[model samples]
Target chain A: MFASIMYKEWLKIRWTYLGGAVLGVFIVFEIFLNLGQIIEFNKANSVWNYIIFQKYLFYSDFQFLPAFIGLIVGIAQYFPEIQDKRLKLHLHLPMRENNLLLSMVAIGTVLLIIIYSFLLIGLSLVTLIYFPYEILVSLLNTVLPWIVAGFVIYFIAAALFIEIRWARRILIGVIAFAFVSMFYYYMGYDSFNKAIPVFTIIALSLSLLILLSGYRFKRGTK
Target chain B: MLVKTSRNILILFVIFVLAIFVPDFYWKIFEKNIRAPFVLYSPVIHDFIISKFDDKTMVRMDNEGNLLTRDEYEELEPLFFYRQIVMTGKMPDSLDGMEIDIQELRRNNFSYRIKPDAIEEPFIQLYPLLESKSGRAKLEMPDEFIRLQNRCEFINCESNEVVEDLSETFSKAFTDIGFKFPAAKIFGNPTTRKPFDEGYFITDSAGDLFHLKRVKNKPYLKKVNRPNGVNVKYIVVTENERREFYAILVSEASKIYLISYNDYEFINTPIEDYDYRVHELMMRGNILYRSFTFSSDDMIRMVVTDREYNKIDQYDEEWISRENTSAGKFSKMVFPFTLSIIDAKEPFINFYFLFSDTRALIGIFISLIIAVILYLRKKIKLKFIWIDYIVILLTGIFGLIAVLLVRYEE
Candidate 1:
């Protein structure tokens, strides 16, 4: 049952996910090219000097890609379900309503994890060519929170758009906005290490908020 | 029951957003930056020089408030701006019968500043240990960085491999000094472009302070004996050319101590109530005297000490936070309560609730009268209209918006 639901979700978002993957790799490729330029053009020892002495960022342009992909995957997955109350057909299946809802969310989440993991691994490989392990670690740590924030935005946006009541939707939206704002607050690299545990808990809990919207939809509260 | 639970959740969300945003909006529109003067002690004049900035123009005055010209101010503050004075050929030869040399002045001058925001901020764990004594005129970057977690291990930068020999030597150095495995905190400037490197001051799991440096090709570890009953909270490494001190150690008790170079000893500075976590510290030192200034958001304290760190004079300045303006006063009257999640001391956003001032009662009374008049206007029965009263009383304008937007539904 879950496989069928996941396939349905994949059918909805496969193109969007592919586009996101292509864009993510392009950004990482751009960072690799830029680093090559810096290392090649500078004098003998200046590349290391600038990197160590100054706060030089390699893949700053890639910071927004995770959020962009998350947004796209979210809209592609849920926008159809909300049209003409097509979600009711999915809910009426032999599977439990909660299972159906959670399975749909899981599909989106797994897709996001796969997409973002590809980006992170590609970034790690690219950074290894010109930079050291220290920078690779720092850059990975810095980008992790932003990526986590991106996925959380997707989860909350799905939950926000599924609700039937405008009043309650706005209320959920305001709360989710506050939650999503936290991930992008721009603390330096590896600073989020301490908050990551707490944020992960919050992000997982947010995955269940779709249940609230389903309940409202069932109640026909519009 | 589901509707009730969901409505309660909605109410809580509305309240949280209103509390955090309303007060923030007030401050955002009414905010102003208050500029304060920089005061420094002049060993040349044996008095304080006030460098006041009024918008774009800067005017200098003596302790007696007499306006001094640029040259006079530069001469008056030779130690503060000694290089500029000497280059401009305005530096006095002697001060109070003590001859002043530019080179000597350069060696002794040092400055330290700590802002409150940096305390709450998180920094990367990986630190580079630059060679403190490279034998060259200039220091160069090391090929590795040390990560202190389960163990203090140095990894080669290029190959992404651990340097076992160097790591073993440094690990053994720490173990010899009774440093417990896995360092708790490591403080180092980590840049070679500074005058010199002081390496890193590492605190082990048992809270013992040890200095680690690569000196003359081998690791030099010095175990610093912390004062009795004092637990160090933060260590600021001072790599001044004079090498008067290795770092400034702030204790959990809010006491300040200087880790001096002579015999690797701790010299107690006469600074009390020095909370490194909350206050910003500005310290300026010259040939004869040092001025230590610490300020929180609302007040500033400037303490002068001689070469021996004896208290010479202390001055205080207290001012109202710009948020206490007329707009702030009006916000108290207009809102029943404001929720704010952001705070200066927190690294991330979270909930903080502030009940409005007693003047908020006026807002409540006005809202109550309006709700009552509406009930009478519609001629609605008591039972159905009761939730409106509850929402109005609890959330003020925020409740009114929620209740009106959603309408009465049960």
Candidate 2:
């Protein structure tokens, strides 16, 4: 049954994962290419010094790309279920309705993880070419919240896109925005040191939201 | 099983959302701007002068509370606003019986802020030792950065590999100076914008202070002796142009010591009773008076020291925090609790709820009345909904809104 549900989700989201993967890899390549140009044009030591002391970011544009892909993939995966009231048919399936919806979310989450993993490994390899472990590790830590946000937005946007009622949808939208905005709040160098645990819990817990939203949708509460 | 779990998840999500969003919304709409008072030492009156924020006007007064014109205020804090005073052609020829050197005054004038957030932020334990005496016109950044774990390793940037010779050289120099390996803390001003690079102030694993600099591509390591019982907590590297001090070493007890260039000596600054966790230290200096202002959200404590590090005078001021304001007061009648995300002292966001004080009882009473009215208007049964009552008792109007917005899953 889980494999069947996973196959259905795969049918719904294959194009999305493909496009998101292409876009994600393109961004990773661009970030590395930009860093290469910086290393080529400037004194490498001065650039590293500025980054260490002044908190210079050579790949800031990459920060929002992960979350953007998450949102696009989420909408692509879930909007089809709501169209023509298809989720009602989903509720009547032999499997438990909650497990079906949650399975869909799990598949999307796993896909996002796989796609983001490609970028993370690519980024780590590119960073190691010039910088030492201390900086490469710090840079990875700095971007961890953003990647975490990508996974989180997938779950939250799934919940948002599948919610039955407009009023609840708006309320959930506002709440989700406030929740996600916290990831980008402190832009200071290494500012997410202590808050990483809090953010991780919040991001991972986004899966549970599908249960609540699915419950509402199953009841057809408008 | 999923419905049962969904109920708990819904409750958790509701609490998280309400606790983060409600207080933020309240503060956004009601927060008032606070203009804090600034204190400076007046070389003319030889007393501390204060410029106070009085609603709409800037009121200048001495410690005695007599109001004066803007001219008197600027004249009093001449050293602080010396350029303006000099432009006004009302310069004092001599202060404290010594002729003021404008050039010398300009050279030493600098300010710094030491906050708990900055000190508490995590750092990469590696440091680059830029050669101080480069023989060039300006400072040059080093080709490698050193990390001292079990031993010091200078990893070159280009090859992304360790320079074993240079690392061993410094590692031997560090061990020769009796530095315990695996340094506890390291502080350095790594920017070339500073007047000169002073390298780094490292606290060894044994909590001893050591001054490490690279001069002409060789390690100049010195073990600094601390005053007995003055344990170092954090070191702030100040590469100011004047070169009076290399760094300011903060002791565990909040005592500050100036790490002077004079043979790596540490002179204790007169400022005292500062806490590394609470108070933010703001230091401003000129040719005459060195002013230290220790501040928290609740109070401002200013101390002035003469050139010899003698405490000349001290003044303290405080105002009611925003949490006790009229808006905060009114919020107690609306929300049984408010949530705060930012720590103000730390650079992070977390869910923290501040329950309203005694006045929130009014909010609870009003909420119950409204809930009863809603039950009557909707013709719903009067049987108790435990969730509604629980939310109202904890969050008052915010809970009421949550209940109304998220209607019963009948």
Best candidate, TM-score: 2
- What is the lDDT for A34 in model 2? 91
- lDDT score for residue B102 of model 1: 82
Q: Which ten residues in a row have the lowest lDDT in candidate 1 chain A?
A: A43-52
Q: What is the C-alpha RMSD of each candidate to the true structure, in Å?
A: 4.5, 2.7
Cα lDDT for residue A62, candidate 1? 85
Report the Cα interface RMSD of each model, rounded to 1 decimal: 4.8, 2.3
Tens-digit per-residue lDDT, B20-76, candidate 2: 777777789988777668888888888878887787778899889989899988888
Instruction: Output the worst ten-in-a-row residue range by lDDT, candidate 2 chain B.
Output: B3-12
- Model 2, A1-222: lDDT tens digits are 788888888888888789888887898888888988987898777777767766786667679978998998898888998898788888888988777887888888888888888888888888888887777778788888888888888888888877887887887778778777878875555667667787788678777778777888877743
Task: Quote each prediction's TM-score.
Answer: 0.82, 0.92
**Candidate 2, lDDT over the whole model:** 0.79
